[model samples]
Target chain A: MKQFTVHTGTGVPLRRGNVDTDQIIPVRFLTHSSRTGHADALFADWRDDPSFVLNRPEHRGATILVAGTEFGTGSSREYAVWALQDYGFRCVIAPRFGDIFRENALMNGLLALVLPAAVVERLWDLVEDDPRVPITVDLERLRVRCAGVDEPFSLDEEIRARLLSGLDPVMETLGHHEEISDYERRRRPTLPTTTALLDGPLPA
Target chain B: MGSTLAQKIWEAHRVRRGGADDDLIYIDLHLIHEVNSPQAFAGLQARGLTVRRPDLTIATEDHNTPTIAVDRLIQDPAARRQTELLRENCARHGIPLFRLGDPRQGIVHVIGPELGLTRPGMTIVCCDSHTTTQGAFGSLALGIGTSQVEHVLATQTLVMRRMKDMSVTVTGELAEGVTAKDLVLALIAQIGTAGGQGHVVEYRGPAIRALSMESRMTLCNMTIEAGSRAGIVAPDDTTFAYMKDRPHMPQGAAWDGEVAYWRTLRSDDDATFDRETVIDGSRLTPYVSWGTNPGQSVPIEGSVPSPADFADPQERAAAEEALTYMDLKPGTPMRDISVDTVFLGSCTNSRIEDLRAAAEVLDGRRIADGVHMIIVPGSAEVRRQAVAEELDRVFTAAGADFRAAAGCSMCAALNEDRLRPGQRAASTSNRNFEGRQGKGSRTHLVSPAVAAATAVAGRLTAPSDL
Candidate 1:
């Protein structure tokens, strides 16, 4: 994954609240084995309207998504984050996000920024009023700026470090192999393992 | 301060504390299914990494498998290929798998506990969100994403930021006809869908303690809908008895030692929580969601709420849009909502007890003239037990399609079974989001008994209404 320090792009506003992962990329489109080729699957159902925010010509190249509260509220699908990234979105500004979605986003290097609802509402007004408004989201500075409104955002300290440096968590955890091995050894005799022979004598 | 149950499990699993950012937590069990593991395996292969502890991991073919007669080869090329990939990955990595036709095969959450692989004070992780269901055993069961899945596959540990603790104490006893599903739905409606955000909720107090193991699973399973990654109930005699006969449990003196430790898995009397909420379980009725999300539900006796009734503009907008998509009229009695389809199976409510509860309601009477009902058990083991108990005969005799193959079925709509445009349903599944069952499909979340009753009445009817 590439590091994310600062991103500059115009914004599109999706005013609907509780935009769940099921709506982000419906379950029907999750059949492919590979994770790529999901750009069109983002809001595939809603895009049929031709007037939906993502479909509007003015927001075509927008990389920031300003959605209402409780965005990405269902399913633990990583494809939801993949969809946003494939569709060229670098950041999503919402008042709140589902716990798992935010975790997925941070892991995959997509910036799921949470600002106050009032700030997000103002962002919608600014972006909707003028589509050409350029927004800058700086992960290092933890700030988001749009016309007249420059507000600070907060991320979990650990998450901020991962995104700023683009760390591979797996590789990081693998570095502490000795610690894991020690923990495994010290686990209680009562702690069962799937490898134990079925109905076998318990560890003593 | 004394530790809560979640804190105890967290502390036990901690491999090392890393600065102020996160901790390295060892994963006790990693459950994999077809939908999410393919990409993770591919990533592992790309990195020249191998599964560190294949013995501690298990795989199943559930999410997209068909629920038709006795395991016909999956016809959908994509779904079939996904299942095939899982088999190949597990084979190459020496991981054990329960395939589609395996008698032990079922939804990941349902099978883990049945096999005695999910134990108290352990940490469980899966690629699916409903993994919270296993927390009924006093474990910390968390749902993770595919990237995290690959991390755990390569190294049996997950790095974590600290989570706040929450207590949802359900006081008093549940009413006679009410079920665990009803109690959870009522709680979600009281606290919005994102109410439990960033916290691991521990269910306690009298009502929760009185529930059976299956009932506890049913309650914890849907905690994800409220934005909590996990929910847990402390280990008690009920949990011990349920684990005793399961396949992987320790035996003889070892069992005694395990139970003694499990008894200490509860929150200390002086434990403190970041937040707490109390619910009167006796006041809850059968709940049915009228809108898109799980939070937009009302009791069977209540009327649909008007969007204008909301104090916040965001909430009012959400309600208005949900009403539009649901095609429901405000002030209409919830019992009067119509449905052409009724589905009764999911990780949330497809255990043997859930099936029996629905079976009792559908024993003699048939579903209404035009209503279509599908009864798919959570697993093949569950299906076999239902058949042994003759629950299949009851379901089929009641005009419902009792399926032989056991998998996710219409719960996620990854198979041939799904709703078409403009169709409505009363589903016993966890989510009622738009297009969840199928495109343009509208769902009303209900319990098994209510699903059976609604099928008979062709509307959202409760067992009491019958």
Candidate 2:
């Protein structure tokens, strides 16, 4: 996990809605066992088109991605966010995001910012006009600042805490292992136990 | 206040209620497969953690296994290593695995309910996104990432955020030749793909109750395409009857006790939902997709939608893009679209009933010229049953390939079974996303009956056409 605060960098535009996880990183590239270095896999399908913004040399090092509404709309593959982060992007601005993708992005320290459709359009227009203009996404203040325009954004309190503190959810949830075990014990007498199922203690 | 069934399940499984945000819910069942389980086990090993409940954890080799030559060795080395890794990891963690040659081995979602591991009023989690398919048993099933999989494996607990409730009530009986697949596809087209985001859709009504257990599974299976993590139907007499005498189901007095508890898992009469929608099942026809996404669909009798049909500019652009990619004209009738292949296996529609439905259409008839059709059973049990019923012979005699090896063959394109570039297919799978079946492969999602009929016609057709 990586701590996320305020990130300032040049932005690029992906002016397409419903950019699904399949387009982010197709299943063909998922064969590797390691999690890192997926940046080369980002948007493999679209990168072949020379006109695609990410293929341009000017947008090579952009850290902010301005996409259309409903970005990351298919599959719960966490690799989508991993690919984006490995490509040097820190935040994605969209009108809406898929629920599972949003959760995966937050857990992986890739900030997904939801802004109004009008604000997102403005950001895209600004970035397209001046490809080198730096956009500052301040998570501390819940605002996105670019080209003299500052817009407010909000995140769920729990997700905010995790991003700011670099919290590992698996570690945080393990603290309640005792309670989970206690519940399992209580369920043993009443519910169907896996032991009974495997050993034929419960009749067929 | 009265509570919905989802609320009731949440309250029962909640170990602790966190402030204003989320709750810690105890998981009853955790299923894993080869593609998603290896990295999770790696995470566990890194932390020096053992599986909290080995008995509750289940693994199967499905996504990466070949659909032919079950007795022969796996040809793909990378896929073979993944299966080997899963076997090694499960053995190392003391977890039971249904290996490739095992009779119980199949798709994780299929085998879970088939083995009676999925029960009413439980919380299930898996690393694969289609884990929501288990909600057919009236459980709150969810798909999690690798990190969450590691979390569940270590602690058997998940920190879950509460989702809004949406009730979809279907009234009226389904017309003949209209299957659950059609019903669900119609709903997705109406609501679009993102309709169920941040909500748990509860399917209820006369039509839903009339479906068989397998039909219910079909309805629940594709709910993920609607962007929902969970979709459920309260347990009823139909559910109880389906669970009776299963190998893992409780027996004697325990059975009666479980049924009594399951009966109380329904939503209260006065319960309210955050949103509500209604569908008249009697009017729906066989549906098929014309474009890349699942939501880009039309009824068999309708024509491809023009961009002018869309009110949203983004939607209009997407329609244009889909047309260009699909190489389809806006005015072309859906039934006029021909296919090069017909696929008949996926988590959505590979059960015994689905096979029988396709067999009925293929019985005593040859597939159209230049068309290749393949039928893969849902599991070894389904294959055995189909063989006993002579459905395999029916498919083979009809000039179709009857494959016995079971897994997600063309659905994920992770194995030897895949569509070649520039191929067109009428498939019984859920997704038709760009290159889902294979790169440059065009897919039109259809029901098993429709898929079989399309095989016989070399074009999209409903069973009525037969």
Candidate 3:
């Protein structure tokens, strides 16, 4: 995980809503087990079209992605986040995001900011007008400096804290291993366990 | 106030309360497939952690595995590589895996319920969003990402924020020819794609209760399209009856006790939800998507709507974009639009019941000339069962290419089976997203019955239209 505070970058406006994970990185490209080298596959299909937003000359190397509502609206493929980051996007600004995609973004240290639709529209206008318009996403202040507007957005405190410190959630959950074991022991016997169905624990 | 089905299950699985809204919840079942889980396994090795509950975890080679050529070899090198990694990871972790040659191999969601592993009052997690399919059994099933997948593999628990509850109750009865697929499509259209975001939606009411277990699974499977992480149905006689003779069901007293506990997994009448929606089941018709997102749909009898008809600016823009990409003209009757292909597979509607529905429509009639139809079952067992019932004969006789292999075939376009560029399809899959079937491929999501009917007519239509 990469710790983050404030970052300034140009923006690329992806002018479509419900931009799904399948599009961000099509399922066809997801063959190997490895996660790296996905930058070339970002928007694999749309990138070929001359009129597509990302293919435009000016938006290349842009680190901020201003997308429509319901941006990453489908699939739980974390590869989509990797694809965005692989394309050098450190932050994604959308009105809303798919629940799983949003979590993936934050866990990987890519800032996912949810601004009002109106605010997003204004930023899109600014970015479309000038692709070099520097947008500042301040994780510490919980505000975005874009389109000459400083607007506050809300994020869960723990997620913000984790991002600032570059903490891994797995380590945090491991800290409560005792509680997890106790819960497992106290779980109702009726609940189906693989061991119950398979007749003893599987050997690792 | 009494707790809803989701609340009771969440409470049962709560490992510990954190200072934040997030709580650690124990996962009773963890499912993995080839596509989204490889990275998680690699992460586990890097972190020097072993799987804490290999006994509770399961894996299947589904998504990346091609749905053609079973015994010979995996034709695609990339898919073969991915499947090989899954086998290695599962073998190292000691997790049970159902391989391509195994009869049990299938889409993770389809086989979970088929093998009777999915039970009421359980918490299930998978890296795939459609894991909600198991929620039809009253479990609190959710989709997690790779990071969470690795965390669960290592610790068997997830630190997560609680989801708000939303109830989407269906009153009245499903009219003749109206299937769960149609009802769900109508639901998404009514509530938009983001309707169920941040909430666990419970599908209840007399209409839902009347649906078969398979149909209930179909309904719950598409919950992700409505932006919900999970969708659940209360356990009832329908659920129990479906579980009765399955391989994993407990015997004698254990079964009775499990049934008794399952019966109690329903929301109290007085319990309130953060959001509520009601659908008149009688009004639902065969629905299909005309846009890139699942929410952008219309009834089969309706025409493609104009973007100008949208009240929201974003929605209007989306409709415009969809119409351009889909190559659909406003005011053009949906039935009048023709398609070149018909895909009858995906976790959403690839169950035995879906195959039967399509078979029934294709029983004595051949698909239209030049209209290619491919029928892939949800699992090898499903395909075997369909063959026993001679549904495969019906499909093949009707000029459809009925496949013996079972996995996600044309749904995500991960395999060799896909629509050619500029080709349109009436598919029973959950998504109609841009380039889902293939690059420059246009998709119209339909029910199995409607898909069959469309194949017959070479256009989008209902079964009764024939």
What DockQ does each candidate score versus the true complex, computed on alpha carbons?
0.58, 0.47, 0.55
Clashing residue pairs found in predicted model 2:
none
State in Å the error of residue A29, model 2: 1.8
Q: For candidate 3, lDDT tens digit of each residue in B1-466? A: 8788898888888888765678888999999998888899999999899999998998887886667656746778877878888999988988988888787789999988887789888899999899999999999898999989999999999888889999999999999899999999999999999999999999989999999989999899999899997999999998999888877577899889888888888999888899999999988888988988889888999999999999988899889989999998999999999999999999999998999999999989989998999988899989888988989889988999988788888997887887878999999999998888988889999999999999999999899999
- If ranked by DockQ, best first, what sequence of candidates would result? 1, 3, 2
Output the number of the TM-score-best candidate: 1
Task: Please report how far candidate 3 places residue B223 from its true position, in Å.
Answer: 1.0
Superposed model 2: Cα runs more than 4 Å off: A188-190, A193-204
Worst 10 residues of 1 chain A by lDDT: A195-204
lDDT of 2 by residue, A1-204 (tens): 778988899999888887888788877666555567889999987888899999998887899999987788766677788899999999988998888888778878889999998888888889888899989999999888999789999898887888999988888877776787778767745554444445553222
Which prediction has the highest DockQ against the true structure? 1
Clashes of 2: 0
Candidate 1: DockQ? 0.58
Off by over 4 Å in 3: A195-204
lDDT of 2 at B351: 92
Model 3 per-residue lDDT tens digits across residues A175-195: 888988898889876655554
> Looking at candidate 2, what is the lDDT of residue B402?
85
Candidate lDDT (C-alpha), each: 0.90, 0.86, 0.89
Name the fnat for model 2: 0.28
Query: Candidate 3 at B258: error in angstroms?
Result: 0.9
- What are the interface RMSDs of all the models? 3.2, 2.7, 3.5
